[model samples]
Target: MRIERSNWEQRTLGEFFDLQMGKTPSRKDLSLWEDGDTPWVSISDMKESRYISDTKEHLPYQTIAECRIPIIPVGTVIMSFKLTIGKTCIVSKPLTTNEAIMAFYPKKGIEVNSSFLAYALSALKWKGNRAVKGVTINKKTISEKNFSLPPIGLQDNIAAELDAIQEVIDGYKDQIADLDALAQSIFLETFGDPISNPKGWKTELISKFGRIVTGNTPSRAISDYYNSQDIEWIKTDNIVKDLLTPTTAYEYLSFEGAKKGRIVKSGSILICCIAGSLQSIGRCCLTDRSLAFNQQINAIECDVNHIPLFVYCLIKASQQLLIDTASTGMKHILSKSDLSSICLPVPPLELQQQFANKIASIEQQKDLLRQQLADAEMLMAERMQYYFS
Candidate 1:
């Protein structure tokens, strides 16, 4: 039954739309996959889009036919239901998702507008059964939640206002991507592409420049090992490619715990060596301060021959190669020896310093853009509250 509000018709979301769960193809069957046009999507693919069309992985049309994986049509609203929750987007183009996502398709004769629903669904918080590890939402949980829907004309108007706000957010994000591209360009101009060696730069094995050390966690049985002071514990989750994001979730430690893992000075380069998901393997983060990391991570320190930022770029450049070499048996693991085996072109110290100088300037501009992006995000948040509340 739809409840009549003063200016809106209230209906449970399940009453308004038919839910379609996503499916993943069996990994054992290699024949099911081939390079083709269909977007094989996961939650990570929707990271930057309001309407999802493209994905990191593409599936052949045959895979869709044989696997019986439902390819969601354009304009269906999709929300992540596991690991990450409440991440919603409308399918602007045809795509398929993994099991973690669910698509909400307008039911027969239901005139619920897609534009307004996409934005509203984002603000719809699932209040039941969110475990410490992750959040899960099911049909029963979704059915109990009330959704207020405006008339079609009013929905269009609100969507227009929200779209205007989204444009500003998108603009700021574009600038951030451009700035990252500029840094890559500068590195290429100075050292040439690492793979091509177009400028004929000398190459050296990574082992020549730095020492790699894997960290360890003190025995969890000893509760006192974790509660001490003056140390920051770094986990794989703390590692991020973006320098702006702060990694915090400090597990403090005393001498007994610190001795178990590698400790490096500030400005050390960190790589995620072990991860449950392959997407995170080979991801790198630079520590602004000294920290201790667990067994899932490996750190490199080159206080003598290499500039920290330059070393960061070089390590970042080799990420794909590192991912390729990572052992994918049970957990994705990039071993210390595997990292040592890789090589990079050693540009002159002065050239590397010049590249670092360019990064310093680019970083300042990025900080300003990040501020603008933050403001745009706030405006979007305010609009969501204004309309949904």
Candidate 2:
């Protein structure tokens, strides 16, 4: 499927497509959003899916006219060019998108393959300004971005080849999702609902399970504290809800820095206790090694009576409670006292062990699926580079 691109026309996106950016109606006006059936696309809606069939939110036709946002036609390619750049998809139906997304229509008398355009746009290495949310690419820069356009027949062939690869990737992702779901189901079947306590298991404050330690960042003013990468430093970003093990940190601290921050021992549970986004506040993961962490997380070193994985899963199941308990303000924060006071069902030690065993098996299966997913993604990345880079 790899073809020489030397003879293909080197062209800017604007030359072949008319660019249109989307707009959001004032969020304060419930009239614009309620009782509406028209799909309103946002960056979140474009995640994972190549063809957008439905969106998370919808607006009324009246709002479309009132907001003066263009109704992108079916099969038109759209790319998110602002924060979280380079996500691209084809709209399966007429829809309106938020300001971050740009719709691309074939210019007058110009024919372009929508699938090829989406793939090409997704492959773009965007350079954008960094802000609080992330990176943002301006419209002018996006219009000037370049790509080589092959003949219509060749574009179709290339799209087909990439689509086949994507199908394989998606299949692996579905299997991984299935294993995660299986774990959740097993947990519920074994322990009953944690919230309702259908099995009448004894409940206690989270503090009863372990020594709770809120993490702290080593002083940045001390040059020696951060000059060398001597130990892994866990941040809120390093914790992932899907994985029991914390990911490698993007940063590290010196041995002197480790003294300033609290060292969470291996096999402890770490939870994000502070974040700008409320959904991020309750994210939890387990520590596989001793490391220093930032103040946004709280670590729990479980007592002899508790299994660390069980406590981690228990907190995950109580995520809604954490969010509900957090103070609503510019930033959501779960204070140490607030986190410790939350009640969790404590089942018999033998039952906890059984649940742990089943989950471990599920985790092993997920690990293999993740390895396969990574390999498939690498192949996809290589193909994309060869075709579009």
Candidate 3:
């Protein structure tokens, strides 16, 4: 695809840089790892970051030297080519990575800007991701991807412009995180940590605070059960974090289908009881409208003494705890009985309402910040399209 034509030349990625994949020592070679200070990077360390400064595993310098593992210098661009394909980041510190990741550096005498190159790769990722397994990109395909190039000065200018927009977006993200942290701080201060119960508050099972309800799927053999706008049918994928908007409940069920599944009203708490992803097993969301869901999920109707918002926060905070109890294999699952048995600090209803009020106010601020970040991202995308589509 031709991104730009005016005052810019098209250069293949391989022409501008050399692609070298990382390496790993043998599993039996205990002497290679745990023996040094060199950072051994992998996909886990990639983490949606633009720049990677540390790694999950580190190799001893002796291992890199003995195994002839080439370490890349700071500022080198890195991309994962297998398992998690298309993840890319730049390094601020020297590190060594595994074979699933490839490091690209400007060719000798080439002055390609690092930030511009990183953003350029981001654009390529959308197009480069394919269905193939194992090796996602071969030398031929990597060499075939072209990037638009202006002179070094122009590249620097574009990179700076993009970086500024990204900085603003990052600032908003940090603010949002701070707001969330504030709520957690309040919870800890008021009710104490649920694990320790330092506040000496009463502790009780989740079931004591709410009634648990699991959903069921309408028979697929009946065509009339689906694709009707009259009802909202939720699934494990429909809930993310604490938000449960209508867009996520894309599958609509007819009135008949609603009969087969558990239809819940607004303010009900939804949790993923079954999912392939263990990380998603315990995620919960509060519904704002009546909804029906399949058997993969369960709903909670908290007692009058408990606030749904407070229950949502407490449940969200205990995600890892829930995941631990989920039976693992092909699909992770937490039976309704197991979910009800999970414990929490049962602070008084008045105190819980105070926390809910604070959360509602904080959410309003976060919503505004999110909208601003969205606008900045749109403008950034437009500028990127102009410079390097």
Candidate 4:
């Protein structure tokens, strides 16, 4: 990660580029959005990607002129500076963004490279006011932040090197995603679709195989409850996609807090019954260790008759049903009653074990890939700090 720092010059971002804060169009004007064609960028669209080619929302061409939104040209570097501070990307086409994002393009007579600028911005240590969701930086504060600027040729070289590392990271991610698909494929091949019960397996309510317990949050006002990290406290955010176990948690509980909350032992299945969106209603993962969780999750401790892993897969395969049920409710949530009554295919114990064995083999390979991904990400962090911090 060593670099020639003697030749690099420190420059404020505002000094090298013309920066413009983006603005949202008036939402009430139906006429302005009638013929949507122009891309509108947002923080969510920049999730873990180096380039933004398209956006989740679009505006009609006329809306841009009518709303007085600045048209950001292709190759312009954009960074989110408000809630999700410092997520940077190079725009692949003409687009406009909401107020939280700021666009930076080289000023006239400057030879700045968009990819290099984007990489620098992404790696920059953003200083701002922190909130529950993310950091917030005003346009003036962000514009004044300084970064090391190497010669134009060095910039190109650095960007190319980083791009190579990024390709490796993306490759590992693709392999992990493929393994997940393979796991789902193995489940379907072994037992058909759980929702359709195509194999004509016996179907029973989820509660028949286990006792269901809904988690609860320990009172926040009681300082003694959180005085020590004696136990792991699980939350919906900890239940990552495709991962059987939860990731490291930011919040922990003391012995006192653990008593206030329900603890589900290892091998029990945890599902997100309450969430902000229908898509998250049925997301489930198996616990690798005993842990206390919040009300957003429901835990099912399977008995000898059913395998927890098998049940996890079955519930996962029937996710659409959970989504539909959540949609029917007044809010995007599934109650304990709702979860307990949901029926799933009941394959024979031997068959369930066979499916679990196949998934275990697939998981072993995924673990190796995940370790490689972690190593690549660590290298990326170190290199970014060396070049930009």
Better of 3 and 4 by lDDT: 4
Give candidate 1's whole-model lDDT. Answer: 0.81
Q: Best candidate per TM-score, number?
A: 2
lDDT per residue (tens digit) for residues 50-143 in model 4: 8888888888878888788998988889998888788998888898899989998776766777788898888778778887777788878876
Error of 1 at 280 (Å): 3.1
Residue 184 Cα positional deviation in candidate 3, in Å, after optimal superposition: 0.9
Off by over 4 Å in 1: 1-5, 18-44, 55-73, 82-85, 94-111, 127-136, 244-246
The digit string of per-residue lDDT tens for model 3 on 1-389 reads 44445777678978888898888988797777775677888888988568988887889888888888889999998887676666789989999999988888888888888888888776765334465553366556776777777778888988999999989988987897888788778777777767667788888898887778898888889988886788888887778764533245778889888893388888888899999889998888888888898899888988899999888888877788899888999999999999988887888899999989988898788889888989988988898777665
Model 1: lowest-lDDT 10 consecutive positions: 241-250
Relative to the unseen true structure, what is the C-alpha lDDT of residue 35 in candidate 4, on a scale of 0 to 100? 65
Regions of model 3 farther than 4 Å from truth? 1-4, 125-135, 242-247
| Candidate models: Cα lDDT each | 0.81, 0.87, 0.82, 0.86
RMSD of 2: 2.3
- Full candidate order by lDDT, most accurate first: 2, 4, 3, 1
On residues 227-278, what C-alpha lDDT tens digit does candidate 2 reach at each position? 8878888999898768878899988888778774378789899999999999
